[model samples]
Target chain A: MGIPYFPGCTLHVKAKGLDDSTRATLAALGLELTELPEWTCCGTAFPLAQDNYMGMVASARILAKAAKEGDGRLVTVCSFCYNVLKRVNFALKNNDEARTKLNAYLEENYNGELRVLHPLELLRDDLGFDSLKTRVDRKLKGMKVACYYGCMLSRPAKEMEFGEPENPALMEEFVKAVGAEPVDFPYKTKCCGSYQVLNNYDLVAGRVKDILKAARVRDSEVIITSCPLCQFNLDWLQDRFADEDKSFSKIPVLYFTQLLGIALEISVAKLGLDNHYVDPKPLLQAG
Target chain B: MTSEEMTRKVKELSGQNPYLCMQCGLCSASCTGIGVMDLLPRQVMRFLQLGKEEILKNRSIWMCTTCLICTARCPRGIDIARVMEALRTINLRKGNDILAPEDVPAELLAEIPQMALTSGFRKLSA
Candidate 1:
């Protein structure tokens, strides 16, 4: 069956590897990702100001497209996009005044019937981890992986009802399903400083340092994440910090789908392992 | 505007009752930007409750990455991140943007992820 996929802005442009790997991984699992027609960005951030109906209009248009095109399920790879789309979906359903105002901006009124889903939710809830285990051809044995949730996928508990907001185990379950050991790290659901990387690199560097330290101390060989922003911050900041901090060790940050692609026996190039700032190829090949 | 007006505006914009905050400091305690923010999360809520209009002008609101750790951990179920974003919106709507897209160096813009650029513009731009 085909699912409506919204690659968002980041995945469509800068994070093609994540988009490619997500498509390949899902295709291997007997699910086809059909891109929604004429979908724009999910406004990147959820406009928290109740008065800003334009942001809701932008997100509502995307949901409208998903409702018109696919099976009323919009799958997103980027956590920021997922959060924005999901929150907007929640508001459009609950707030009548806001919904009426936002609907005025759209050609067809969205009745909040569309469901926004993350790739992790699709794998865990839809595909079932057990089913995924049965298809694993190349087991990631002896691989110590740290599953980073990075806020967006599991935060604002009311909206993102995927798992435990603070300490999600869905990725860990997926790792175990692929036959790899999931490391328990304290900073798994911690924020990676999100968009602060644009202006405040030092603050992000400090947070990334702590996140990586927690994983490394747990003896995790690599880090797996679902968010493009989290992957970019964790991977790119590691390179920036490596020059300043001599004790800093580089850990390969791969999308969870990339790791799943490896366990599914998909080619390394197809998973976009080469596109990562810190090369995951060595550790992935060694596994 | 007076402090009462500011508080009223915040409550209206965020649709969150700041009076519900019990001062448990869970929001402040869980905030990741505590080191950078001049006023912590709990303090930001306190400023809103006390109708301190100056809180809108504080740099603490902009420093927030909207990570929602505070909102997730709030004992009173207050959406502190939304409150913070409301403060930013008030500031931005008043023609006080933290950063302009034209001012950002092309070299730095090219290096950062597209998510950062897009979300930054949404949050920081007027």
Candidate 2:
């Protein structure tokens, strides 16, 4: 399958591992990712705020790029970028007023009509679980892990409308395909308060505690998430939450791809599993 | 002069669905962080419906965490989260802030070097 790849800013900066692992996984699955030339930030959590029009225009700009880049779906590894671009497309494609405004902006400044897709959506909906299951060689058995959906993946499910936002099991099913136990927890769709980390560390840490605690109770060896922000807050903030409440529990937060990379017998280092704040050595070794 | 006029702007932006919010307090009741909030989710929706731009601008909007419990439980499906996001967007437009104070959260930021070296989770920032 050919798809225009849009790696949001974080994937290149903070969550490079996600990009690397996703690339490897797609390649293993026989999917070709064609990079969009000179793609810009999707305006992210910023545009929709500062200027809905500008933010959307920014999103439309990327769409125009993909549409012109020939024939291929625009696939993204970053949830934020995916939502931003997809939401804009939804609005522009459905609302004439929005379409007029966006088209004008595109014609004058931009050039593509690329449809956006989250990597998982592509695999689950396009590739089918049966094919994915057959491709799995290393089964991650006995690995007790929780799936954290965070905010963007399924929220405002109507607006984002990827799947069942309330309680999505696709990622869990994928993890299960790899042979790991996907722990079910309450805070799956809860917020990690990624944007609030600075002004209120205490609050964010408290929220982090709640998420990790739920996973811990389930005996999840490490929490797995698709969002970079959620993974950062859950895995990185374990210590602070613990400090805030010395009785705070600690659990490594793992990326879905890292685990996939491992199951495929890929080098752990190449997967960036060792880059986590919490040492998952115990958990991975235990698995 | 009237409370209705105060929320006129919110009413316009949200398309007046919030006007039907019966004050059932279901939003506040279903909110995950109701007790922790200064105005609660219901109150925020009410304020937005009435066009209380300043209240919508409150950092509390950003506090929502985007959990859809309020929407999930609302009888009308008012989408309280969207109201909060709109406010957050407006606040951001005015340059009130960027990267939410906890962009990376302290504990998480501290783990950057370690997570980078150990997690096999590629660090794009170098």
Candidate 3:
């Protein structure tokens, strides 16, 4: 069965590698991801004002499109997209007043039929870890990976029901399924200062430094995450930080799908492994 | 606006009762943007509870990255992040935006990811 996939705006532009690697990894696991037709951005962030019916309308339009296409489940790789879409879906289903107002604003009656899912959830819950193990062509033996969940993937537990909000292990289990060692760290669920990378790079750089330091202290070889913002902050900011501090060490950040793509024996170039600012090829090859 | 009017507006806009906040510093402690904010997360809530409308002009609300750590850790189950968003909404609705698109250098704009631009504009722009 093909899962309806929503590749948000960023994946199409800055994080094309995530989209490519995700498609390749899912294909290896015998799961087909079909892009939803005419999908718009999931508003990136959920609007929180009580009277912002227009913000809810923006997300409602996307969900209505998914339902109109007859898709029961909508899967996305971006944590921002996952968080916004899931929260909007939860509201449309649980809050009758909000749903009525949103439906009226969008001029379409949506019954909140589409279910939002993260790609990690699909791999962990839908496809068994054993199934993933069977598909791994190259075991990532001795590779110490810090599975960074960032903030959105599992937070505001009531809305995001992926796993344990504070201490999630879905990524760790997925890493182990591909025959790699998962390193437990304190900042696994820490915020990477998110969009502050745009205007306040210094703040994000500081948070990134702390997250990387935690991973290094735990003896992690590389950092793995599912969010593009987290991946960009952790991977791209290291060089900028190293220029300011001589003692700063570099750690390659890889998207979980990219790591899975490597274990599935997909070629490096095919997975865009060389596209990272800090090259992960050396550490990946060492594994 | 009077303090009572500001309190009523915040309560209506956020749908979160500021008075429910017991002045616990958990939200401030968990907030990642504590170093940057002019007022702490708990302070923002306290100002709202005290009906201090001056918080509306504070830059602390804009500094929030909406990480939700404060909301997740709040003992009173107050969605502090949402309150921050509500404050931003109130500010933006006044026809004043925190960022101007043209002021951003084209080169920097070209290099940054779309997620950052989209989310930033959504939060900071009118």
* DockQ scores of all models, one per candidate: 0.75, 0.21, 0.72
If the candidates were sorted by their lDDT against the true structure, best first, what order would they fall in?
A: 1, 3, 2
Candidate 1 off by > 4 Å: none
Q: How many backbone clashes does candidate 3 have?
A: 0
Error of 1 at A281 (Å): 0.8
lDDT of 3 by residue, B12-114 (tens): 8888988899997998888877777889998999888877889999988877888888888889988888899888887798876677788567866776678
In order of appearance, the predictions have TM-scores of 0.96, 0.84, 0.96
Please give the lDDT score at residue A125 for candidate 3: 72
Residue-by-residue lDDT tens digits, candidate 3, A1-287: 48889999988878888999998888778778999888888888888888887777777889988876645898889988999999899889998988999888788888777889887778877888988888886558888999999998888788888777788888999999998999888898989988776656567877888999999898899899988888888887788788988998889999999999889888777687877889898876665
Q: What CAPRI grade goes to candidate 1? A: medium
Query: In angstroms, how far off is A282's CA in candidate 1?
Result: 0.8
- Candidate lDDT scores, in order, read 0.85, 0.67, 0.85
Higher-ranked by DockQ: 2 or 3: 3
lDDT by residue (A156-232, candidate 2, tens digit) is: 67777766777877788777877788887778887775545544566667777778778888988878887777777
